[model samples]
Target: MGNCIQKTNRVVLGFDHSSGNVSQKFSRGQKKDNNYEKGNLAEWQKQKGFGNVKKTMNPPQTPSVSGCLENSHPKSHPLPTPNPISNTCHRGHKKQPSFLPLPKPEAPPSKHEESSSIGTLQPAEPSLSLYSSSFSCILPMPMSESEILSSPYLKAFSLDELRKATANFCENSLLGEGGFGCVYKGWLDVETLTAARPGSGMPVAIKKLIHSGFQGHNEWLSEVNYLGRLRHQNLVKLFGYCLDGEDRILVYEFMPGGSLEKHLFKRNSPSLSWARRIKVAVGAARGLCFLHESKSPVIYRDFKTSNILLDTEFNAKLSDFGLAKAGPTTEAQTHVTTRVMGTEGYCDPRYLTTGKLSVKCDVYSFGVVLLELLTGRRAIDETKCEEEKNLVNWVRLHVLDNGKVFRIMDTKLEGQYCKKSAYVAANIALRCVNHEQKYRPPMTYILEILENLPSNKNLNIY
Candidate 1:
């Protein structure tokens, strides 16, 4: 029994250090490698509250929306089986074809031209006229692979330049590892965006892809397509990319505060005050709202605590666009039908069962994060008793009950927040997580509720 439990831990909860992003799920037939070392496992168990488990196991094969699934949890607390959808096969879909060949890189624009053009570009308006013109040429509608590759907004870096920036991808510089590959800490000149000494210039996070990993060129292209054009304070800034030889690398601004998942779940981290939690919640909602309200709406297929990054000031920004999809283009079309892909517990029940996705899917995910903020609990935790294993299921009743809501609030908060405000936030989460897709509030509406919560900045901290 002990060996069985140890194997289960490896298969289900393989921990990725630095960033808490869950590792990719392994298929039943694939060989299991010891990707995570024993020392790292010990540290993970200490920090995350897992006890007496040391090995990883590959569990029975289950139907996944995408051929690959992200961030799976323990088998004892398996995700609810999705109901079948008409026209959808029970077996996971095959890998889609690779994107078209990228056009040659255009000459870098003059500093003045680059600065001036960026200022004129605005978020796509409801009319979409802005997106349909010059902006639309580079947008991800039908995904013009050539236009996205040549856009002046992104810089094309040579492999040698990145080697200097990342100290040859040194082991000490590693920030985290995920399904795609490992992320490393690097530095670059603020103005020229060229490689710089370790402690001298601007810091950046470089994601270098593993050629053999589950994610591949398509996912890398998806990030460049969306983030390459869209710009907002709430979204992480993509500085550039490297496509030399078989290597695929992405450069993004370094987020000094790490991920929200660490702050909320890591044992020794400082507790986020009530006001700070509200601020983070509002910031994250704004990012999602921006994506949904765009001229060409975007569905953030993967939304979870680990993907919500923070800066030194505690401002939250959304990251990881690998699974994001473009929404329906015409009003007549209600939802986009695509492969299901997302973290296990946070995925919308409707989406998982039907493979039909819309902006409401993102709303459901936001609600799960909101609950995490209010309760300081993970979406899934095997350490707890069966009844309490799933955070959403366990808290649904308590959050709705006026008398029980307070009991569920994070004890770390120490009753510093206003009961009235807390109750209002709880109700908003309940509405967003409603099983019926239509009942879920849109990201815009959810943003309004979070922003308007009274005394958001000045909540008594004592």
Candidate 2:
């Protein structure tokens, strides 16, 4: 790699340096810090907790955990529960699935009973309506996976099939604990969804939901609706899902390379090359671009490094569509108004202010992910100094304003990365996290810039 890398190096040489437009030069992907002064937070902050802007400094800690939504860490590589993933995929031949949504739903009351307790039941229907908040009422009728998923690519998996394939959920078959439960590695005949000889069958990851909740129910629906239907190289492949009785399971293609978060944050693992990081970013951006550009746009609500899984070759694939929703449409220019939900640091402030759900929210979250990729850190770690816990705030205050991109770049990269390329990448990330949603760059443009980074590899090297 050379001393400088620029896609169409839009890095403007002689501006005020602090001006917002400086970032627009490099592939026009720069987003600025959110002082939140420009936006009208009067109504938003007027609400109970939103009012006190002063007290807003990391109140109660948004918790670095993704709850049922966080997918990586232990199960990504199957190195047991608490071990850092081995650097090489072949090192231990271990793999697991931590990327599924929702456990089984609580059973509804039987027909002849007087409805007591906090339970509601509705008509069991075959016509699937995905937007239900409480699935207990609108129980899913027994339908084959192929029947439920309109797409020819997806199949319906049965509990028996999943159980047998996973060797009856044997401990040795366990991969890792995901959002709602444990993920197990299994071998099966894809055609039959039946247990096959260990090495003879297709290798797959099965997510077994342990607990259940209303939000988890909705996320599970979201997973089935989106992952089951959409197809893209950067998006993880969903072979099928299981909804038998109280057992809710998801089946996915095995990702031997594990999660991007582990590769970046886990100790003792090899660091990803600068080129590979760029490739991963480009792949993820392409996935987002595909979603946004799809016939029906999707908002990947949870755009974090942990959700980006990799194959043996280190090709990144976007996982956990449990948080994804359809993007705002032309008719809904303002935003798709809804309850505020997302990881704290990565959430777009504008969305919280307006209760609006727009594609821009995803852009803001992706910007945070870019920041994480640039600096190997968690979005929120209680152990970190109060200010540093929130990666966005830290980057904006330190790197973006200071223009010390070199200081912020992950030291784990050692001296392998190109400084100029690093600077440009930081600019791209800054523009992405800009407080104003409009200022954030679109994934399409972002993808174009990232895709061209490889050409600049020979330009900048430490």
Candidate 3:
């Protein structure tokens, strides 16, 4: 009888005399030969209590097999049955006894269960999503569609808040009426909105957009764009704006004393004193100087008393910018040609005839204002005698002669004003009104001249 044995590192397989093959795993293919000899496999089976082990010719259709072999803290076979083979001699099974079954594993806790046991979780350690949420909280809320369209500075106001501040556009809140809009006296809710008076705790003038029927859109944009960016003591500040449907409005810091025109024309009360008049004229001159000599020169196209507004202290600030134009060139002599636009007596004759506007145009208007200040007389009075009426012609005829200068001085001044300073001012006014625009001194020189004039009002009269 013959016996076959195959040895591996930790396992051994043997074939009996009756089997043709011996292996640790089962296969579907049938064995080609059956050995005729009976060998030591019988002796191995008997000693292991595996009696008369024999090979099967035909394998089962579905073989019970394991993908991998493992161990329970030690070496273990992949056989499904705990003790499938009692002896190795029959079909290459191991000689030792199989191990015991493994114990079942414990299940893990769920999210809800874990939370309940541990306590509330710290907000899912802020991820990118959390950062986005935080940013949303800190960022300003978006304005409505109407506000976005109408207000150039949309960040300044909301519709509902402005409505409340203006008492829902009440008529009693009205302050001054004009072509572009009406100015209203109203208490702003500054506590919540930055557009309101900073910390004054009082009312402000709100210049709401009126139904002018004209193309005021450009004017609205101009005011917000320029005034929104400019901050100075001599410039009127634009506080905020509202864009609620068809109603577009702008708010400005109120000027209690109103415009210079009201005082000059005596629309409200008696004319201003000579001292006050000189102060106002100089203040207005300084305002124009700032506009003309700024880093980028700004020419006041509509330079007149009406465009000058007076604050609580009677301090003058340039108010209207709708017609203000930037200088054409860097040279002080640069002139720009445009359609004639300005009040009659105040308009520069050269600018009107040649259609060429320049800083000199502003200079000419200032000359007229200076005349108003010195004589307390209207630039052109139709009611006065022909020779005495037009202020420019009157000044031209009288300024060179000293005695005629005194007669032209405001009677209200009563010879109680500074004659030397008044003469200096009149000479400056003459230069400003000179027929040749080139002969006029620059505003800086004019400012220097005015500054050097003594401000002592108590000096003895001429």
Q: What is the C-alpha lDDT of each candidate?
A: 0.68, 0.61, 0.57
lDDT, candidate 2, 246-317, per-residue tens:
777888888889898889888898988877888788778867776775545678877877789999888878
lDDT of 3 by residue, 1-462 (tens): 222111111112222323433323210122212222233444433443434557542222222122112222111112232222321222333322222122211223356542332222232232323211111111111244343344332245666666666676678777777666677776654444443433345566777777652326665665665554444456676666766677767777678888887887775477676667776776677667666655456677676777788876787777866666657656655877654555667777666555677898898888888887787787767779987677877775554322256777877666767766776677667667665676565665555455545555645575
TM-score comparison, 1 vs 3, better candidate:
1
Name the weakest run of 10 consecutive residues (lDDT summed) in model 3: 131-140
Error of 2 at 448 (Å): 0.8
List TM-scores for all candidates, in order. 0.70, 0.67, 0.61
Q: Each candidate's root-mean-square deviation in Å?
A: 19.4, 20.9, 47.1
Instruction: Count clashing residue pairs per candidate.
Output: 4, 19, 1
Better of 1 and 2 by lDDT: 1
Query: How many clashes (backbone atoms < 3 Å, residues ≥3 apart in a chain or on different chains) does model 3 have?
Result: 1
Best by lDDT: 1
Where is model 1 more than 4 Å wrong at Cα?
A: 1-142, 401-403, 456-462
